[model samples]
Target: MAYKMPTQKYSGKILEVTVGSDLKLGGESVLPFYGFDGNIGNKPAIGMEIWDIFPESWPAAVLDVFKDAADDPLKWAAYCVEKYKPDFICIKFEGASPDGLNRSVEECAEIAKKLADNLTVPLVIAGCQDNDKNAKLFTKIAEALTNKNYAFLSAIEANYKEVAAAVGLAYGNIVVAESSVDLNLAKQLNILITQLGVKPDKMLMNPGCAAVGYGFEYVITTLDRIKLAALEQNDETLQMPIISPVSFEAWKVKESVVTQEDIPEWGPQEERGVAMEISSAVGVLAAGANAVILRHPRSVEVIRNFITEMTE
Candidate 1:
């Protein structure tokens, strides 16, 4: 006898967002990879990260991957695109940190313009977390890439007004509204951005994610709630696609940093670090993230294979 599939139905679908020239993300009518019951819309995109300045303190496992191109942002991005082949490139403005390089906003904007001009894929431009700096940096980037239409990393409730206003200046650009692990905060931030004249389709959410061994469950639970609110509760405010900077947070943990020499029982350093990132990426994707920003090439390859298997 043939068996029937037990499927779950959703009342609402996540909004479809087009980035770059023609890349479309999100638009799923059910939970992730439930193709038998609903549309997967688009495959979850991978945004490979490239820092504007050489990441001096990055773990060897990550730095070694970009060793040759670390000094040049443009080349680094190109190498990531050509070699690693992510769906998009996310240029992180780590140089602009107040205690760091304190690179001028204009300088960062210049880099963004050059990357946007040269790359064929979409760009995800992330600014420094400092609200004041991000406000200045995002505005300058918006003006610099005015006609290019790239997405900006974030506009939080604390400073969404300035960032949203600046990003809204670009016709096809979108903003990631970051909130704490709280669902209400996520919804509220989305509402605030839409109120700033940005449409709901032009937004993404980043409810803070944690590394696998620490608060990883928090990331999954929070994402599940946000997705449920969007798909089941039919909360229009929470319907936009979500992004998880999996590698960004995963690499910061002790598991990804501590050398095997320091702790002989931790197994191999590179393998351990990769596992942490891969586990986090898998968890977030299953929880409903539309895309994940990754740092390691191996992690990207693993996640891509996993996605391919699930979709197939």
Candidate 2:
């Protein structure tokens, strides 16, 4: 006799946020990959992240994969989309940082326009993690690419209200609200952003992520709590779809960046980095990230396979 598994019905579905024209994220009425228990609104999406400035410090493994393309954002992005076929391209304007290139908002906006015009997939514009600078950067970029919809990498509570009004209200571009890995902060940001008229359907949430072994359990626990709040408890604010940027955190860790000479038994540095990225990415996806941005092609390949096996 076949054992029948009972389904735990959920109250609300995660809002579906569209990217790159027809591609949609979220929409599940139950926990991620528990389709037997409920509906799977959409299969998870993956992205490859690149920087506007040459990532001179990139690990040899990743640099080898990108090679010449790493020298230019447009070339880097083209290479990623053509070779790896990520669901989207996350263009981090690291050069715009006041400490880095200190590029003016006007200059960064122009570069963003170029990427938006050239890329086949949707663009997720990322700032250099400076709240004040991002407020200006996001606004200028949003103004530049009006009507040509794209997603922002994030709008933290510190600046999301203003960003939500500018990109979301002014240009109708998708907004992403980010909060540290805390359910209360996540819900609070959602509430604040929505108050400014950004619909959940037009917004995504980023529960700030950590490297696989570095405070990563907090991320998983936070994601799990968000799922519990939204699905069973019917928490509206926390129901926004989650997008986790894995590559930045995964690649910067000591395990990924340390050299073979520095640590003899750590195996090949490239393979180790890719393994870290894959572990962190898959961990986030399983923990309820609707989208994850990875760096290495190999990590994307492995995670894509994992997503297909689980979703299909």
| Per-residue accuracy of model 2 over 156-195 as CA lDDT, tens digit each | 9788877999989998898998888999999988898889
Clashing pairs in 2: none
**Candidate 1 ranges with C-alpha deviation above 4 Å:** 1-3, 170-172
Task: Tell me the lDDT of model 1 at 244.
Answer: 86
Evaluate model 2: give its lDDT.
Answer: 0.89
Off by over 4 Å in 2: none
Q: What is the lDDT of residue 53 in candidate 2?
A: 88
Steric clash count of candidate 2: 0
Clash pairs detected, candidate 1: none
Best by lDDT: 2
